[model samples]
Target: MSDQYLVRIEGKNTDIAVEETQSILDAALRANEWLPHSCTQGTCGTCKLKVLRGEVDHRQTPEYTLTVEERAEGLALGCMATPRSDLTVEPLGNVSDDGVPRHPLRDYEGTVVVLDDIAANTRRLVIELDTPMQFNAGQYAELIVPEHAGARQYSMANPPTETRRLEFHIKLTAGGLSTDGWIFRSMTLGERVSLRGPLGQFNLVAKQDEPAILIGGGTGLAPLKSIVQHALVEDLVPELFLYHGGRRREDLYDVEFFRDLEHRHPHFHYRPVLSEEQWEGATGLVTDVVVSDFPSCKGMSAFLCGPPAMVDAAVKALKRRRMAPRLIFREEFAITPATSTAPAVL
Candidate 1:
């Protein structure tokens, strides 16, 4: 194997390791340095950085996402660009220095140990890692699929306490490459796989008694479930409202679990909204349910995961309720095009 190159951030004294196989964003994330990004893919362009000096391979990014003129101007999309050699890059913004020290980035070999159906089109995949990969409650991992040239990033539905064991909610979207091509139809037990991650910054804060409102759509419930479970175990959050939405009754599969949680915790509230179905509990989009329930969202923290549109809608609703912009955390399942140059909402 070849040696990884050193990447120096243009404006900061920080230096990060970059492998030719990994995107710059992923490398920076592994270093636990917060870089501005939405979806860790080329679609959003939130992670676009200026290549002050160095050679880069921007071919990983979709042609449409970055223009030739931009490339000529020494611009690169951090989520898609891989370092061709030693480089100096500039971040679009800065991150808080008050965060916890990040876990070291490491590669782990794993095999498929468990696969079970969770919802209408979702499956729970559990992989036993070769070594423990410590991650925050709401972070994600990019699994190295056997066939695809690019890996797909999925949020870990389990917390750090369950070290060495990674669980991901795999949603089968229409025309998805890995989900349909291999994972669902051909992947078998004991099949060897590789993963690198514990990526992203959407996580729980140390607010012991604050209300935690979580909104999820489709398969986006994975990380939120992890957060809720961690909070419950630590007895951190006193009040919680989890609003999950789907088209039909089958979309929201964890109602019983939330109901059970509500039974045990007086402050915990479960609101599963169905868009197409006329459910008696809550109807319409999950954002609508969130808005209707809390007309004024002051002094509350909200975590949202789902398609870009749903997450945006939830942010708008929460802001309307007077929820502080800083308190609203989000992880987007960016919808990719038919080419799937980027990973879709998972």
Candidate 2:
């Protein structure tokens, strides 16, 4: 059966429809509305809001982050909660001083359509959504695998225009939850799974004409790749230099894709770095490479996606080079199931 509801935010109203069983966050995101959130599995406080009127229920949530008093006071995390009746929600974004957008989290069921081993340790998986899901290219999704209470977050590897199909680059982690279903492993096509989001505030600023330095490490290359692809398609060709790093050559999955991008777009430059080996390519930590290659980012903006360590390192290096904190946009990819916990405060 289907459920319908009216969501009122900031004097604007939107009609949202959802499957009777889906969460409000899933439905709202499916409709293509911006929502502030991170770690859609209830870990990031970005989607929290006040229920001005009406009732809701969160089927899967980390209640530890919220006090019983808070829930009783009408506080809820939209990504974890589902509307049970017509609702008037004071979207988290509307009351924020930072201007971050709080969008509804939408749900989708996608079938694993293809899986390709792009590198020795990284595999690319393609899922075809039952219906098209619109989102900015760099946004991510929380994939819920059956039999596991936890969710895994991953960024899309394809351009937004390719709505029905979503691509992801997965790196095998020692104890990763989704590692059991690796694209290069025994997982088969046609297996269906549930997903939530289009979560994240990382996207291109429409009017910003600053040259962008794109930094990615390991499978973190997924979102950066999508952003670059979308940037090209949208004709926002600010001088771009993409630097991707890995421990060895095999970790740089889809390496050829970036090479082709540089060839196709004259304004693009590609740098692939391997730290543990001598392959005659750029050699050093990715951040160090950026420091030695483009030391001063005085008038440039930087975008980064990777492990927390890499993200932190890149941010520090950029700061030393005179890049503003506001000029650096980033998305840190969370891989383990347990890492998808919501924050106490957004």
Candidate 3:
């Protein structure tokens, strides 16, 4: 079987070899070029492109991630999408043949520092890198598990600092390999793991004076939390609202920490929405709560994270509220066969 294909990005004057099983974003990033992307898991539409030529198998792409019009226009997500032919595409945003920070991939060693529960289905993971590593907020790294052939990806929940301590919010999916195999119960302090990356194009792009909107579902809060703190510290946005959702009250963890952030910064606000349980705060889906707060997200840059469905619905809702498609950013924690599908046990 043909395992590779050529990709020519329009206006970029860049042509790179893309493997049949590799993501275009992966190839670009490996080549030291930044593409507008996040999640890199086929959930975020940031890597969306207009396919001028060639074909792709979007079977693994989430239905909620792209719109019908986008599909009709021959668009596809670069992360989960694989080239089926020699291809050419027009990238949407956050790109340039030159300009913007491009951190070349590097390898590092790290020891597990802390593994504590942060929510009902989530855990707070802290890793102490042997050497200081740099990465933009919202970027993730692959944690190589000894028992697995492939590395599992996790987003850093903290902004860049001089320290090597990185944080992550890991959700223990039912029958999850890493969760069940090591992360949840078996992993121990001082355990060493191979780390590579500072990967993905999910970094923040601060637009002056525009209010930033962030929404997260379940453990999807990882990168968004990173982005939020980074934005506030850098003064990236004058004001912002973060809406986090879960099935129950327990899922909306870290409420107090966020509330403290909001208290300290008048321009920043946090709202927790629960679907299954009633609360004094906003109820129903997170997207609905955001819409109810503002009829339209005009002049706002919206960042969404979580499962494919939540990210999709939020993106659509923001668009309907007159938010430009370009203004919305995302990362999908999709429940795909590769990640979330549990095997039948008899």
Q: Pick the candidate with the highest TM-score.
A: 1
Candidate 3 residues 1-346, lDDT tens each?
5488889888777788887777776677777766777555555467888889989766467777777777888998876677889999877874754334667656678999898887896899899999887888888887766656455678889887634998989999787777777798688889998766778766684446678899999988888888888888988888889989999878877899899999999999999899999879889988988999998788888888888889899998999999988778787775454432211000
Question: Model 3, which residues run further than 4 Å from truth?
Answer: 1-31, 35-94, 97-99, 339-346
RMSD of 3: 5.7
Deviation from native of the Cα of residue 7 in model 3, angstroms: 10
Off by over 4 Å in 1: 1-5, 11-22, 29-38, 63-73, 208-210, 337-346
TM for every model, in the order presented, reads 0.88, 0.78, 0.77
- lDDT string for model 1 (159-268, tens) is 66998889888889666677887678778889888877766767874545568899988889989888888887777787888888899988777678889988987877
Candidate 1's displacement at residue 46, Å, is 3.3
**Could you say which candidate leads in lDDT?**
1
For model 1 the local lDDT of residue 231 reads 81
Q: Report the Cα RMSD per candidate.
A: 3.4, 4.9, 5.7
Q: lDDT of each model, Cα atoms only? A: 0.79, 0.75, 0.78
Q: Please report how far candidate 3 places residue 319 from its true position, in Å.
A: 1.6
Ranking of predictions according to lDDT: 1, 3, 2
Lowest summed-lDDT stretch of 10 residues in model 1? 337-346
